[model samples]
Target: MRFFISVFIILTSIAPAWSDETRLDYSGRTVIYHSDVKLRGSQKRDVRYSHKANFFGAVAINTTKKTNDSNGAAWGYHNLKTAQDNAMRSCRFKADRPEDCVLYLSVVPKGFDFKPKTRTLSNDAVEAYNFLVGWSRLNFDSYRSFAVNGIHTWAYSASAPTREAAEKEALEVCEETFARSQKKKDPAWAKAVYLKEHLQCRIFVTFSPV
Candidate 1:
């Protein structure tokens, strides 16, 4: 039995499809994402433009701003502190629920042009996140929804301002994407986001405390 189990484990590990990459998840919680996208609408523009506008912004804004990438993240945290005193006060789990449950919040964040070839959003010295929680399978509920943003198709970023700029852009995206987040003040970062020439897509994460 031990030999068989060992063989099975080895076979599965050697399978062609396993990767540590966090693709296909809105926030990669290992399971249960409010956002999940299998592929990009366009490879060149580097975005799913329409989705970025409402989903990352509006949804996060609508909920308590427990996490915000723009407008000073600390401000968002302050709002969440206030929600506990107001409307959400009536939620049932506020009293007897187990406090040990862990939760995670992720936003579709970005990487800058000059950020070294291997450095990422989470740098060795700088913690880029606005909020991070120790997560567990027990802590939360989940939902997934995608509206018909518009026609879908392929697009790419515009020709770079210079060859030097283009090369830098590619490298930055490659390195930054390895561990990126979803927060935006504007759409300049993504070269392609949707089926159209002029749009962007973004994704964000949030959590509600009991």
Candidate 2:
């Protein structure tokens, strides 16, 4: 009876935490986003590898100051992303089979063109990204209107073929996303403020030392 009781305690102790790790995982996948956010396009995402440090993911906002031939504002938009709600979650990273790897709940800023560059990468990073983008684009295709401080944000499908059309779609999303930062800053942005709209967005959440 005592041996059976000991086994029960051991299993009980291990179960919850293990279940917690399984919190983000369903089947063999890492679940990063909640059941919201809309995604579109080819909708296929590929993961990139990172080297050195253990940085899970980094959120980046693309800045647009390269358009003017004089100022050279050609880079793209500038905006900030939100942090993940984790206290209600089981773990910081996605829960999966490996169990120890960390996943960055990346808050991708709107209009940040995630064009891939030929940089050095790592195997784990490659593995992690492979899992993450699949999840993120799903959120994007089915995104919800996140209302921050009364400013409601929503994402629309990108209208293609023309750069001008892409720009319009990008500005629409960025304007909404920009509202998040603006709300955090007490809702202050003049009509005169320059908005750097992007015609493309490419998020590269790889494991690298940047």
Candidate 3:
């Protein structure tokens, strides 16, 4: 009896430490997410044109008085140093003092592009969205809705012959669950949510007259 009581006390004491560590769950699988913050955007721009050779691009800014007179790809350079130097020189050419210009940002091997698998919106909602194989001739739409509370989530998905129907079904399922909670006199920590907007969905989808 003493050993069992001691074990219970020990577990209760360490419960707080376990609660601090959060886990990520998707499709019934759970994994630890060490960080809570998510990246929404960055202050960077892609090159308008890229050279076939190993080319470097850079940005230089006039730091004297926070001027918008910046320069990029002023003179094509094979090396980063040369690119940085030229960019600064170009920026200084338009500056009141030539020495006020400094390198602000740089991008190398211009042809390389980076894309994120998921996107977070301004509302602090993280989203994972993709379109299945569909065209005007044959439309099969699928959508998912989720309600989240802190680290917990309830999700529902539906597939239909049209986008509107699929979206409607997903919302109905999610809201039905919410309505049940209200009727049962049980308070819910989460609000019903819809995750339909993709940050870069238009890049992949194109509309044509059928």
Best by TM-score: 3
Worst 10 residues of 3 by lDDT: 5-14
Across residues 1-210, which tens digit of lDDT does each residue of candidate 3 receive? 000000000000000111222222233222221122221222122122222222334455455444332332332222334444555555555567766554554434422223432421111112212222232234323332222211111222323444444444444543443344334321221111111221011221222223
For model 2, what is the alpha-carbon lDDT of residue 171? 43
lDDT per residue, candidate 2, 1-210, as tens digits? 000000000000001111112122223223222222122222112111111112222211111211111110001112111112111121211122222212222323222233654432222323333444454455443322111111112232222343444334434553545443344321122121222222122232222111
Question: Global lDDT of each model?
Answer: 0.20, 0.23, 0.30
| lDDT (tens digit, per residue) of candidate 1 on 105-135 | 1122222233334222221102212212232
State model 2's lDDT. Answer: 0.23
From the highest TM-score down, the ranking of the candidates is: 3, 2, 1
Q: Would you give me the overall lDDT of model 3?
A: 0.30
TM-score of each: 0.15, 0.20, 0.26
Q: What value does the lDDT take at residue 152 in candidate 2?
A: 17
Off by over 4 Å in 3: 1-54, 64-76, 110-210
1 against 3, candidate with superior TM-score: 3
